[model samples]
Target: MQDLPFDIASLHAAYESGTKPGDVVAECYRRIAASGDPGIFITLIDAEKAHAEAARLGPFDRVAKPLWGVPFAIKDNIDAVDEQTTAGCPAFAYEAAADAFTVAKLRAAGAILIGKTNLDQFATGLVGVRSPYPIPKNALDPEIVPGGSSSGSAVAVARGLVSFALGTDTAGSGRVPAALNNIVGLKPTVGALSASGLVPACRTVDTISVFALTVEDAYRAFQSAAGHDPADAFSKAVTTPDLGTAPPHPTIGVPDTASLEFFGDAVQAASYAAALDTLRSEGGEIVEFDFTPFYRVAEMLYGGVWVAERHAVVGPLMDTAPEAVHPVIRRIVGAATKFSATDTFNSLYRMEALRRTCEAAMAGIDLLCVPTIPTFFTVADLEADPIGPNTKLGTYTNFVNLLGLCGIAVPTGTRSDGRPASVTLLARAGQDSLTAALASRLHRKARVTLGATGWALPEIPEPAPTLGPDEIVVAAVGAHMSGLPLNGELIRLGGRFIATASSAPGYRLYRLTGGPPFRPGLMRDATGGAIDLELWALPLASFGAFMAGIPAPLGIGTVTLADGGTVNGFICESAGLEGATDITEFGGWRAYLAAATDRQGAVP
Candidate 1:
């Protein structure tokens, strides 16, 4: 039992063969001891308590409890009933009154809590060493700095001390650690998971992220943990779609040559080039775009009004016990005081302009792919120049939440010098399933072992069909897609998303002239290019009411899928072409709509 890998599938296999939950729980502690990394945890649940919880799980019924008997940990900033919520500041520590919303959800799914991991003070740093405690060693290479503020969480999962752990991402805290530690980091849509029990760093953009050995494990944890919490004003019911196949020939956007930054690491640059080649080989159409807007947005995260949000949470602590805060964190969060209320509004205005520019840059791209961290930083290097190295670490990650994007950072392969290499796939919020599916394919292609465990990558089964027997398949290519404005209508009508499917080579996508919620016009044309669309299973009973809501220039028509299958979907009449802008270059309505989120509206 101690020799068994703790991946959900392998653990479940052992359980089926009569392995006991308490034994698995005990083995986790044994491995933690074997690891000899005190920096990995801030507080651990008692071994006896863990065993008791494992024993209380009773029968191994994975159907009712998907995470049954699985061991996991959370960042100290996150609350667990009776555990101390330190937020990495000893002076600010207090006992948690209840389990965090996500913790409760995971516990409900039958996962056993093992401990609270260490992190950057108040989740403030990208380099994890800001903690009052000892910094976690990078799981892959001890010489490298463990990425932060989720350092301990990432290392714990990387070293296989636990199957998965939860970390918080405000400005790259979640992803930077995974890239450094050779693990999968899932930064979910900001509102997808409830934030009721999480200590705020930058409340507007903060999200609790997952660190796991594989994309499958990470996404599975996401499904069990995601839910709409009415108590949390920021929470939203973002759909957790099945990890269906990625669209063939996806239009992937990458940083243009002028925008590529490696800080003089030729090996990192070469590895990224190799990864791009792999994507091309996998049938993705690589399009290069200016990354200047994104880089500016990343700059805004730390250098803009958002810093004031961090100040809001820790100001009182700083006033009462300034010495308790990490010096690096205090300096960074303290800068917020220089700005006035008017300065904040000024930054917000500038932010809107930047967002519009970025949205326009991403107008036609399916998803953006970038190096998880531009280059590596050694512990010695960070110690020599704390601020420079930490600022450099957020090169690719700091812009995500401010832009309302969902991202997953997955290990691609090893670099030339044997350091871990990773890339993050990002899309508009609520499009997590698409990124995960693509990430899964990319991970499988890399053939990398799971974290520091060196356990071979396991096969992830294809997702089951989304349609029910009584449901009729209806295709959507416009705002009706997930996370878009019209998606609510589908949910109200019992529409279940099946998968994102590509159309045959005879369709043209257009942005139809419309109101605040702009709509798309997908039309079949002999000379048109292939486009992407969503498949939804609508009840046969509700089909009539759904069709009745269709306006002029749009009506139900037979749409041809890349697989040669046909389904009822939206089609624009030729008359609609009079005022519509051709958006076929963007490939799909969702891509077109991504820019529409800007205040100036859809700038195709």
Candidate 2:
């Protein structure tokens, strides 16, 4: 039992084999004791207490509780009823009166709390060593610094102490640690998880994050925890797409050569390059874009009023007991005093502009992929220069939340120096599933062991999330495809990408004569070819509005997939083909467009 892998799939296998949940809980405690890492937990739940929680989970019903009897931890900053949330500042510790919104949801899903993990003081630093308590030693290498401020949570997952754990991300708290520790870190869209019970660290952008051994596990934990909370002003209701395979040919945006930053780590740079190759091998079209605007947004995190947001949470403590706060945190948060309300407003305006600029760079790109951490930092390196290395660690991560983007950090491969290679897949807010889907593919491609455990990565199937009563699935054939011109119309109506598929044979595609944005029309014919198309789920309420916008010659009709499954999609009237040119040999509109551009030397 001690040797059983802590991954959800493996653990559930043990459960199906009649292994008692209580014994599994006991084994988690045993693993904790054997880990020799006291710094990992700020508050360890009693073994018997945890067992009681597991015991309460009645007979196996994964349907009622997807996380049944699964053991996990939360960062010390998040509230769990009766537990103290210290935010890594001992003087600021207080017992939580209630479970956080996410906590209650996870518990309701049958996940048992193992303990509360350590973090940087006031959640102010990225290096994970700012706590008054002992810093968690990096699970991969003791000489390296554990990433923070979600340090212990990441370390705990990396060490296989738990199946998954909750952390928080404002800058790179959730993701950087996952990279350093070689695990999957899911930094959800801000407000996707409520902030009501969390100790604030830039409250406006802070999100409860999840760390797990695999993308599927992290996503499952996220699904269990995420819900709209009316109590949290920042919370927004966003739809989470089902976990399916990524688009068949996604346009992946990467940093241009001049904008790529590795901080002199050749191995890290090479690892990132290799990861891009893996993405390409997996059928992604890599598009290089200017990453400079993103860097400008990152600078605003600590350079402006965002620091003031962190200070807002700890200002009173700093005023009353300056000596009680960690010196590093005091220095970081204290600097917030320099900004006036005017400075705050100006910074806000600047951030908006930078966000827009960065968004432009992401135009026509399905997703962006970047190295999770620019380079590695050692414990000794932090001791020599505490703030510099932490700042460098945020080089790729700080801009994400500021720009309202969601990302997941997944281990790609091992660097030449034996350190982990990780890259984060980022997409616009509410698109967490798309990033996770690609990250999962990338992780599987690497074939690396899970964290420091050496357990083989589990082979898991796509989780088929049951669609809600208010939802409807639609197939998109041309401009409505993701990253295409008219795709935003679908998104504005809450359309979420599901998967890419090919239309059933005998449906010929043609470039219908039209104006402004050229559109494609699919017509049933005797010798038509299978054309590429994307499946998207939209709200049933908005389906009428989408349907109302369909122009002449293009109307929604039942289109059969190559697999024989049918979906409602754009179909053309036979009369609409009068002036159309058949492009069936191109297979898809995107292919035909590419050929047209190559021949005509301009976009169609």
Candidate 3:
């Protein structure tokens, strides 16, 4: 077999060391030819054209460009100038005059565009076989469906054809295929990536997604491709931080086991159970919650008003040339003609009610965990019941975009039957980094090789963990340190230890007039104040719980640390200082205790 574990970073390193880009381009073609999988690509870029593009880069320049010399493929639904985009429908093929917004971004970042890969016709199906084009066989097992419409893109990455590929997801096009192929798929928030120049799926909810072997590579590709585009009306110039690791003990919301639907695939059901065990092994807490509201929201996609959006895009073409669309696609899109405007409005109202229920259901969680797909299906199964199994596969995926959440699919392990098993971590918009962090750890825990490739897992430097946006750092001056009674509140809420440091010099501590548990108040003074404090990272999910436990004048607020970093710490309001006796001479809480012990000269 041709090399199964190729990545962009490695290729760039080889190019910088002296290998020619043309040589690597030749290797890509050689691999494509050797794979004997004609279903992988709808239209490949001519080898000669690829070499010409590779030759333009004089030398590898990682500083000026990140993806320099990297090779990648785009789903045919996305346009690439000079390449014909069939979108899995040869009769509807068109030669793109210019690259899609995502393609233009990748080219600017110095990534080589290999070609357009196959997909379900019009980006309509979750099963890979929905197209007239040959179905890209599952990378792990040829017996199973490839999982579409990002089917080819996922398989190419899994087979080491490219380091990463772009796939558009309206429902689960980006995630489903990644799960099927045993790779990482990052579906960013709707407006996170610019969708200009791409064919519309559900125009309002469409996003270009990333498929790569590792979470780091996927994130790197996302950062390069994502940014506000003035050309795209849907694009937003929102602030986004680079991906970071999550603090230990993340609050992961899990669907109630009874709510999970595996459709009688016992192997898949067992795989999911093992995945939850894997999460527990990593120090994550799984909070069980009802998933009915989410399921109701998902139903709206096929049964509600959104199906009309597909009709809106292809309805005209269907009217003009119904024969051109695939028979199944034709039947589905034609159903839109039956719904009147009144039906659309009724769906809109029902969806709003469902959304509220979902919001309440998701009240206090940092991330939601779900099987990437409910189960696996084979090409024969698809042939037997094309629509049924396809819908079942999307049980956990269909409602994500409708609820406005970001998700990343990461392979966890292989089932006993040898098929891949995966899980997706979800977060609210702007929490992409949190999901990436948790997903990467889960990927490593699976201990699986990269997709179908035999490549050993690369040694990735562990990312420094940080608190999420909702989290606030707290300073504990008294008994609330690690391993203490009060510390349990913080730990239960997904808090992690950050650093052990002292406060700035201008602080005074006083033993408050309290009993049973004992309490202390910290006051700021220009002349004298010395209080020792330990910093603990607190996630937003449990910040309120910690705050409510505080008694009297001591409250949570920002405090400057010895390193000049500010975090939410203990602060005393002015009124509490009246009856308190000053103990400013001691530099810290530990020092004050030391003095008291020395003065008494015996253990109490």
Candidate 4:
């Protein structure tokens, strides 16, 4: 019991193997006491009450209650029933009669409430020090600023005091802290998780985020919490897609050299370069794109109308008790008064133009990878220049929500100076699962220990091929397999890679004759051996268009997999096999292509 890890997988295994939820709850308090960081939590639930709630959870029942017995903390901004909600402003505190929409959802899923954590006042600053409460120490190093306003939530998870903690991200509150504290931060798509009961920083973009020791835990918590809530007008009916196997080769976009900024930190720049190398090794093709338009969009988040949105939430308080608000926050949000209705419209117009430019910049890319924070800032640096450091900390984060993108920050490695190195994966809204799937793989590839807990990442098995009910499974033997030239056609048709599998015994694979970008033909064979192929899920509505695109010998037909299950897949007419090269013995198209490349290289 003493050696148990708090990651969701390990904790659930412990529960199944005879550890009780009461004991887990007790251990959470023990870890919190050992941490010696009172700043990490604003208001903790009584130990007896937390244990009582755990007891009510009964046994481990993951299917019915996914977060059964999981201990989680909430940022002070998000409400939990009977808790005082404070957006890091003690003067603005109020007793919440009910839980935030997402919080209630997690609680209903069998998660035990631990406490309300600290944050920047009104969730205004990226620096954790903007709070009225004592600042949370950077979990890794005391001198460094714990990234905020989700600072305490990230620290609580990093210190292993909780399995996961909820935070809000309008402009990187969720991610900056995770990167600085060496944890996983998942800023889900806007409105994917209900914002009802959360203190508004920028109501339109605010979202509840998750911090955990592992990507799997964070994603699992997300699965439990995400759904549509009619009570929350901002909520969307977005589905948390199954995270299947990573695409064999993904095209990832990186900021061009000229547009990349590290605030003169060369070590951080080199670390980012190494992180990109790791992605390349994981079968990612790195494309450097001009980030000028994106950076301009980022600037608009703080430079324009968005600040007014923040002011709208706290303006009356600012006027009543200006001194009660953090001085820095007051100054930042106060600037909102400088803009007029005309200015607001002008900024919106500019934002729309920039959004178009940024979208164009990302047209062909599957994911955008960027440094979670361009540079690290120390407490002393913030003390020296509070505004500049906080603004700079948002370098890669501020624009994400503004552009309607989803992002996750993952720890990549440690710098030579022992600081954490991290990269964020960004994609269009509702592509949360795609970025998370890749981030999970990348996190495992980095081999970094979990947060500051010294717990090694648990071994993550390759995801099994799966599909949602609304999708149709399609198997591809050659051209449409991941990394193949024609694979984009499948992607354009909304296909998600499921797995690489072998066809049921008695299938023949051949390289079709006569084409620059040749195709493959799969046919039934009475005495044939198994041939390798890939399975993907296409939306039911898009299946027709996909079938229409097939030409000549290739057409959709029922194909059997090694597991004795059948799915719609590609097959060929017997006539198309004329002059074709028998490639069944190569196992798969990738293997055949590799051998061909080797043979061609040997020619000289």
User: Weakest 10 consecutive residues, lDDT, candidate 1?
Assistant: 595-604
Q: Return the candidate ranking by lDDT, descending.
A: 2, 4, 1, 3
- Per-residue lDDT tens digits of candidate 1, residues 272-383? 8888888889878788988998999999999988999999999999998899888888899999999998999999998899999988887656678999999999989988
Residues 473-577, model 4: lDDT tens digits: 999888787756577677666677888788899988888886656788999997777888888888887899999998988899999999999989999999898
Q: List the residue pairs that clash in candidate 4.
A: none
Off by more than 4 A, model 2: 463-466, 482-493, 499-506, 514-518, 526-532, 544-551, 561-565, 585-604
Give the clash total for candidate 1: 0
Better of 1 and 4 by TM-score: 4
lDDT of 2 by residue, 297-354 (tens): 9999998899999888999999999999998888999999999999988988988888
Candidate 3 residue pairs in clash (backbone atoms < 3 Å): 507-529, 507-530, 508-529, 532-589
Q: How does model 4 fare in lDDT?
A: 0.88
For model 1, the stretches where C-alpha displacement exceeds 4 angstroms are: 468-472, 475-554, 557-604
Backbone atom clashes (below 3 Å) for every candidate? 0, 0, 4, 0
Rank the candidate models, highest TM-score first.
2, 4, 1, 3
TM-score of every candidate: 0.84, 0.95, 0.83, 0.92
Model 2 scores a C-alpha lDDT of 0.90
Q: Any runs in candidate 4 off by more than 4 Å, and if so which? A: 1-3, 484-494, 504-531, 545-554, 562-564, 572-604
Task: Give Cα-based local distance difference scores for all models.
Answer: 0.88, 0.90, 0.80, 0.88
